[model samples]
Target chain A: MLVDRLNSTARRVPTWIVYAGLSLPAPWLFWQGLTGGLGVEPIKALEHEYGLLALQLLIAGLCVTPLRRFAGVNLLRFRRGLGLMAFFYLCCHLLVWLVLDVQILAQVWADILKRPYITVGMAGFLLLVPLALTSTDRAIRRMGMRWRQLHWLVYPAVLLGGLHFVMLRKGWQLEPLVYLGLVAILLLLRLAPRRKRVAAHA
Target chain B: GTALVGLAGAGEAQEALEPNGWDEITSYCNYYEFGTNKDDPSRYAGQLTTDPWSVTIDGLVERPGEYSFADIIAKMTIEERIYRFRCVEAWSMVVPWNGFELADLLDLAGVTSDARYVAFETAYRPEEMPGLRFPVIDWPYVEGLRLDEALHPLTIMATGIHGRPIPNQNGAPLRLVVPWKYGFKSIKSVVRITLTDKEPPTAWNKANPREYGFYSNVNPTVDHPRWSQASERRIGAGLFARREPTLMFNGYEAEVASLYEGMDLRANF
Candidate 1:
């Protein structure tokens, strides 16, 4: 009954509201970084915050299908917005690393090539590029079934994102490992078979 | 060459040096005994009991015994030393440390002729330190330096910062300050100083040898495997502040470069 109620309420809410609400944190975080609210090392803190938000958004995107399949919650309309927002945050994370953290242009390229964690993170960001480009309604209708196949790239993209966080930490830190573990569990949930609908004749 | 000349006039260089604010020095720390976060030590280190402390000076020392913190302070002549503190994470700070040369303490203990290395151990109190609950890099953090490096005039055992007793978060009672090496090499809340022949295993090096070498001298050329050591961000520098190029031996090349003379720094690194 709660799931049904949630679904009914969800239909009345404009999907743009979710986009507007989620986008609020980005500017607020930037303002915090500017105002010294991010502490002495604001750049590092800002970079970390953006990366964390991006990972969280990716994990949230992974939850949509399972929620619809099991809980009977129809959040399909907001899935695109979630995916796009995750991409947006991922861009912010990458930009912060590039423009603010490692300012040297050659060094940035060197890092992406040399560092395994950066390589994995860059690969994850690259995977989302096509998916984001094709997120439009026209592109979705035009491509049809192929669109669904293309969007499945999110699975590996999110896994790599989680892996990046794990590798970036100094030692076997709990927080990053927990994020990676949560991503593993959510991904495993996707593998479970969907329940067969009962036949009307039967 | 210019930097070397600047450092040659050590007294004048020190006068020109501006130590970081007390807030920055005390708050931003990597005392993993307390916690890993920069502010974790400040938040959780209050639980630590630092008074009435004693250090055990053992392994090839004539006066090898538990020396009370007060006795050590009374025996030695305390002086202020302004040094550049460089972390392996590529951040740096200028700290004005109040302590005597480590050689003075070693002299008090009377180092044996065969002692090749000086290994230091941090205080291991699980009841006081929450971070110790997790097996983060094998608890009871240990670090070591060659006997000569330990005896170096630049090497000091700091008791206070900014002309006041050190805050618990910043290794309250006693801590090593090796200006030339990475900050982690300077062990914190030191309880034991053992002079040994064999090279003692260090905490970070033991954690990841590929990334953290035993001789983690602040050399910009020898980058950490995970990240570049080419440039460092000053801790209190503003958000838009440009990263300054990291100097050889963290701008203490003139003072410490000869210690590693013939040895290959890149290989050791």
Candidate 2:
């Protein structure tokens, strides 16, 4: 019966399950850092690790559709889990700042206002808040076509987020630019000729 | 007064340590390196060396002696003075600093007539302080104060906060705490104090003079090149809460506003 269950959907890409499996390490690592089970300065490393993971997950979430379309695989399943992981990491990033770093709302707000990168980063996070809030199947179904429209905000959010990292640097560097390029490509995908035709048809 | 630490029995000796209005003052920080993210310092600050820290007071001062953070702390009385800390970037945090006034230390050092300004420098360790690896700003972080600015009644060479010892992340042992100026003006983890006649160049000013000036007083009217400084979100308050108006000198106007009366604050800023 198990083999039959596996065989029935064997050809289908279990992308969501794969993404969920991939996200397991991120939270486990973050939890370890939060609980002081890790090495010296666990909270410190956790902050960076989670933030980087969040960005990487966002990048991977974007890549899922492209990879699936290009590689001829049914990978829509993975997109949800990977995208949710991005949301999860973003939450952890916020938590590290809220709980361990600033620990105060006023200071956090002040920091968001005082620093440009912080402001942009926070704006990016703010944009994600609504998207994450409505990411569920129920909400997506309820919202209908608006859901896809709203999800488009992620394009700018990720772009701004990449810009936030670059601005934080004292001088222009290559790493942040690479992230920016990924965001650009992700956005460029939206501008594909097929996207235009699809929108026209809709 | 190291003995003041032992004076635990004394209660309500001073004003209650009021929060300056940050939504989360407990986590508000001034560590410039570690990427300027509010939580970045929590990760990178552990690498900083706070023990056996000393400041060499030289230049125009007659008593140019190296004072260990221990000697500096024990000698002065600890007071819980909540200060409004405004960063040059435009955010503000009201911190309950624990240390005596800078006047106490200045009097001990005995500044000479030639002393026009006091310059502060942080330890230059590129290896441990990870932010130093990239020249985010000029190395050996610097800050300066006019003689009057240094002697402001509220200025304190802060050693602690929230009625307890300062955590290493928040400039432990010794740091210049100037509530009236931007947060960076309150140089942290101080290593050198030089009294010089020439106006000293600060870290930010050296990195980008237009953005940072020597007399970086907390000003709401003057906008930083990148952003506005008209208001601030008080840390420790709930998220999305109403904000308060930033004061001329962090609401210490009664004591410090007069000091900058004649000077062109716009130019100075």
Q: Please tell me what DockQ candidate 1 reaches.
A: 0.67
Best by DockQ: 1
lDDT value, residue A79 of candidate 2:
67
CA lDDT, candidate 2, residue A1: 65
For candidate 2, lDDT tens digit of each residue in B81-199? 76667766445665777788787887778899988998999877777676666656767888999888787667787776666666656776678888778888888788898899999
- Assign candidate 1 its CAPRI class: medium
- Residues A85-160 of candidate 1: C-alpha lDDT, one tens digit per residue: 9899999988988898899999999999999999999999999999999999899899999998998899899999
Q: Give one digit per residue, the lDDT tens place, for model 1 in B105-158.
A: 999999999999999999999999999987768878999999988988889999
Residue-wise C-alpha lDDT for candidate 2, range A136-192, written one tens digit per residue = 889988999999999888888888888986876544445677888888897787566
lDDT of 2 at B218: 75
Off by over 4 Å in 1: A195-202, B1-8
